[model samples]
Target chain A: GDTEPHARLPTCYPYGNLNVDELVQRLAQAGLADARVDDSKEGLVITLANDDVVIQINEFATHIISANSSLREKLRDILLECLGSF
Target chain B: LIMKNNSMKILGVNEAWGELGIVSHQLRFTERIEVEHIGPVQALTSSLHTLLSQKLGTTQVQVVSEYQLSVADSVVINIQDDNDDPGKNILLSWTHQDEALGSKLLEIIKANFKK
Candidate 1:
């Protein structure tokens, strides 16, 4: 059996007015392969690259968690870029 | 981390809401203080204050805003502030690879305000 590593970077975003559908499309367009969304009690969970990068959107802010630093930075940059379009 | 004016007083401490599996710490201060290299930049603080103060369509909800800064490749600190309440804030710091650095930063922050 193998163990999985985890890391979390909690940050705020304009989530109240976030358009999830558009965000996913923009992420895909940004060359981010395997961006998936799942519903949760708090909000939506956008997982990229087999759970290597996970963005958890709550009512207040978004938490970007990933085991890899580069992956987290790439996803965050794409998300920030996409946020401007929304 | 070094500070010139280290008179900011800590008023209280409480647990804050954090994502699952992530440990968070909260501290209340009498006033906000500027720190060397560790303090948030003016633009970031302004953005956080604006986001915290904005009302969401007439709802008087408790707005929580956070700003993440990567002090190092492995150490990251997420500073959280409350809407309309600057005295009460949270400093949630963690490290991806180096836990010691993250803890040291937190300790430095705590020691500065403590003095």
Candidate 2:
């Protein structure tokens, strides 16, 4: 438990007034198609192909990713491809 | 002091842990504290500061009082192996008077972080 279970992605660039739902949908479709997007107690939880990777988008619009170092970077790359630079 | 019942509502939990064993958690919440015991706003804020410092094990905590009146208080806590990224370090946020939630959270951390 002392060890962190997930790696976090940096905050995404401001979305301005873009709809979060639509944005997430587009992101999933673009690259995270294999990932499952569900609303958990942790806001939006994205389960990526790598079981270790978990992404959460909170109500405050902050995006956090958790995973091992290698997996985290890989996920970040994929996310950036979908969500753009964060 | 019998007053309105104010409890803390967990809005969200953002966590990021690295292979290096660094951990960071951002907990967002809404607070409705019964101010009867804590007295006025200023005093209540100070009390919250002390409480969080004790539970979180760091006086580095930073508090922002803007949302205290609206119940939209939040706390961003980052327990890391390194604190070089001063920019990302969480000082504090809005305050909550819910001792149970705070204690539970701390307990979870201790249970998990046993080293």
Candidate 3:
């Protein structure tokens, strides 16, 4: 069995802010034919599988558009920490 | 494969909320949930500081400036001064990926590489 861990990077836009379904569709349209998407209060969870690796993309787009512009640093830190956590 | 995500710390879930400074108390309130919660750049940086200190160990935290950097995985963590709680900052990087393989041999490097 070939079992290897894939690097999963999750980018979130909280507040039900991100259009999870639309993003999924866009990924498929953009040639990401094998992306799987899910949702939670925090945001969306996207999973992509390839021959050698599996990637998890989690994004919670900002609920408040006004706040989104300012939260970039915290968001970046949150993303990296989230990636490292798993 | 590399996966990346961004969001406020998960408020209600215990298992899912770690590394992002979501304490039980902080998680209780909706407003602090700050998922995409923003302010000026300084405010954002402050938020990041709080998150990093809570999730990771606090003493060695570093404060990051100028959000522009090629590599996004690393962060700036702030270390609090014991005297007055005025603090210093350090760059917090989860830079263990390469070091994790340090013990492996050159043959393993050539043979077992998965990427």
Candidate 4:
């Protein structure tokens, strides 16, 4: 029998030692809402207009988890742009 | 926290619905670990189940993906195998409050999947 194809997985990019607090502020400035550091201080959790997105960042990389592909891409672009200025 | 050789990524949404309490982690395996008669996700999941069961001394580890698993109802892990490429990474996530359990799970994963 032929095997089924794997589902599309989200991508993770490495960014050395991001200033997550500052990044959250930048995300807010970019009009993203509810952007705050998670209680664990392990990552940032942000809520989109119609979807909930969790962006987890540590010393090595950042992870953006969302079901909406388009929204995730948009958020990724905005995040990279914010990081660019830093 | 992130691992030295393992990069983390997320793929799916929070199935828990409207609950920010649900957290996820993704990690990539450096080399492809295959099992006959199963896909990458299932193969990984099986390996995780075995490892976690042995380590945790229980057989209740839930296989979430080839690279992902859940244990003791506290953490949920997802391994990434994008576009049919053998996954080299994994994601392990949990609620904000379960930091202790999360850390233990991460350690188990790191020990087994060291790059």
- Highest lDDT: which candidate? 4
iRMS of candidate 4, one decimal? 14.6
- Residues B1-115, candidate 4: write the lDDT tens digits: 3222465544334432123332333221111222222355667667778787776656447765455677766567766665545434566664323434554666667667645
Give the lDDT of residue B79 in candidate 4. Answer: 66
What tens-digit string does per-residue lDDT give for candidate 3 at A1-86?
A: 11232233323322222344555565466455676656655544455454111222334222211112123233233333333233
Docking class of 1: incorrect
> What is the per-residue lDDT of model 1 for residues A5-70, given as tens digits with 9 covering 90 to 100?
222332332223456677788777867658888999988888876745667765444566554445
The regions of model 1 sitting more than 4 angstroms off are: A1-16, A49-51, A84-86, B1-115
Q: Is candidate 1 or candidate 2 better by lDDT?
A: 1
For model 2, what TM-score does chain A reach? Answer: 0.44
Residue-level error in angstroms, candidate 4, position B60 = 4.3
Give the alpha carbon lDDT tens digit for every residue of B1-115 in model 3.
2222754443423444444443221100001111232234455456555543443335434554533111223321222222322222222222223212111211222232212
- Residue lDDT tens for model 4, A5-84: 21223333223355666767777776775665554465444444345666666554466665443555466566555442
Better of 3 and 4 by DockQ: 4
Alpha-carbon RMSD, each predicted model: 21.2, 19.1, 21.0, 16.5
lDDT (tens digit, per residue) of candidate 1 on B21-93: 2223211111122333334444444443343224111122122334544433443444543343333243433
CAPRI tier for the interface of model 4: incorrect
Q: Where does candidate 1 clash, by residue pair?
A: none
In model 1, what is the error at residue B71, expressed in angstroms?
A: 11
For TM-score, candidate 3 versus 4, the one ahead is: 4
